[model samples]
Target chain A: MAVTKPITRFTLFGGVVVLLLCLSVFPSSGQAPKNKDLVHVEAYASHKRVNSGKSFHIIITANIKQGFHINSHKPLDEFLLPTVLRFNETKGIAFGSVCYPKPKQVLFPFSPNHLSVYDGKISIFAEGKVSRNISSGDINVSGIFTYQACNDQMCFMPESVGFDIPLKIVKAD
Target chain B: MVAVGGFLIGIILFAQVANHVHKIFDPLQIKNLVSVKQLFSAKIPEGVPVKLPDLIITTIEGEQLVLKELTSRNRLVVVNFWASWCSPCVEEMPHFEKINRDYQNKNVTFLGIATKDLLSVVRKFIVQKEITYKIAMDDQDKIANAFGGVKVLPTTIFIDNNNRIVKIHKGYLSQRELDENLKDLLH
Candidate 1:
């Protein structure tokens, strides 16, 4: 019984060391899964370099997975979830209305009415203006693109894929 | 050496506790904390009975039939409106088949209406999916519009023996949900 107390303390110290070793060996293994592969997004700026206070277009091209289509930003049905783009507030940047390409009218076999949907590739354009006071350098304007994709037979869970648009703010001529 | 043995036992006990905690607090299970009905935003009719719509559709087999003709057989009719491109609609087909098989002898009918789909695609999909229930194609979208304008995929309508619509279930229905919805029809 006398030796049991020292043994407990010794075991505790050893357990702590083993736990630390395990953590060091497998860093980032316990993190929550990331959003990948469901949908691919590519951001583009109309002009790589724009004068301060001048407006430019940021185009986001979303390529849906093969055999799948996402509902248009303005879905014909009220119940259907529409694709939406939300921009995060950033300093020295002013964003305008986002314009989405018109959806192709698809009349599925199950319904007589045509649905508003986008398949393969769809582009969303956003107008942005750099602040006059901003310095001449590259800056990123990030945002989220959310959509629900469905193939010929089933609807997948909705996903929000993040996107970043890089633009260079040059001094006015 | 005895002290080391005691430490090993303590480690095992701690491991067991951690596992139990993980099971109890699994976030994946908690992600769907909202009610099942919240999955869709559609305004579905519940319990309030309505008469079956008078609409005819052509089956993929090229046979023309009215939906009520099947309902008039004095059995509970489950009309599911689905499309080949609708993912949720495809996912629930197997469950519908299983339930259809179980109620083979019972006075029940499962009718799947393929709307806005091509006949070639529907024929190909049925063979690939091995669908066993009755499938009809509404190429003209007449049947869909008759059923209160089926705007959503996987909209299931339940009609009683009296040819009255007992309920309209919108969205995907799990096995348990199917069973729950057919309680009046089966039992």
Candidate 2:
């Protein structure tokens, strides 16, 4: 019985060590990437218009990969950061306020609170007007879009993306 | 039997140690993806003197109340816009309740406005959380629009005695943040 006891103890200890090794090698779902999931940003205009006196609207859309949601322009709470859009202005081209689409409500696991966010795709409308004094040429508008992405378990660091769009200015009379 | 007992003891000890490790590391796992400063730094545009729409809501006590009347007094009004569905808003309720109690004797009134939610839900939430403060229901979101389209839940607007909006705080507030803002308004 004394010999059996030592063997049993050794076996139990070995089993525990092996279990821990397996856990370290393969982490559980909770330890998986909460926000490393890829998010795609795409910009599209409803209609291509030559720069004219009339105002033209360009839509910028962000399409998040499945199983992820980006914080909206306005987050429900302080802990959840808001997405920001910076517009680089040109000398003769003027841009209006960037309008954001309404976001869907999401519930996080760690937090019982529901947050407003944009999952899948969100469209932001940017309207620009060409000045009458502007000559016919290609006008470039560039800006950095910043936002934080999160899932149920954790939130990822905020990412800033830069994009530029060129529009050909044409005289309309 | 002694070996089994020792193994059991080891297992228990391991579990206890793991639990402690988890507790210590759980908050560290929280990546401050976006710093709290970013949220607080969002510039609240100057308060424009636009005519605010009148909001009539039923309080948790079933009292029908008007929003403008609540602002008639020279009290520091903390109007919090939230919904029962919001997690951070619910998590911060107890803190808000404590703030209300702390400032009860002072010249301050903390009002919670339930926006984008049904009255039944708000009632159940108030009862479940044992919220003692007066919660006004903004049906049809008219009250939310009146307050410049709350845009997000858990948005708090601090108004001074003169009915001018002194500061706007967007998001869940810790007890300290609430106390600090209230102190500024009171003083």
Across all candidates, what is each one's fraction of true contacts kept? 0.13, 0.06
- For model 2, the superposed segments whose C-alpha errors exceed 4 Å read A1-173, B1-43, B46-57
Model 1, residue B67: C-alpha shift (Å):
2.6
Q: What is the TM-score of chain A alone in each candidate?
A: 0.72, 0.75
The residue-by-residue lDDT of candidate 1 on A66-121, one tens digit each, is 76678899887645668998999978899999999988888664345677999987
Q: Which consecutive 10 residues in model 2 chain B have the weakest lDDT in total?
A: B24-33
Model 1 error, position A18 (Å): 67
Model 2 over residues B82-146: C-alpha lDDT tens digits? 77655557777898899888888886787888875677778887888899888987767666666
Best by DockQ: 1
Instruction: Give the Cα lDDT of each candidate.
Output: 0.73, 0.68
Give, for candidate 2 chain A, the lowest lDDT window spanning 10 residues. A27-36
As a whole number from 0 to 100, the lDDT of residue B141 in candidate 1 is 69
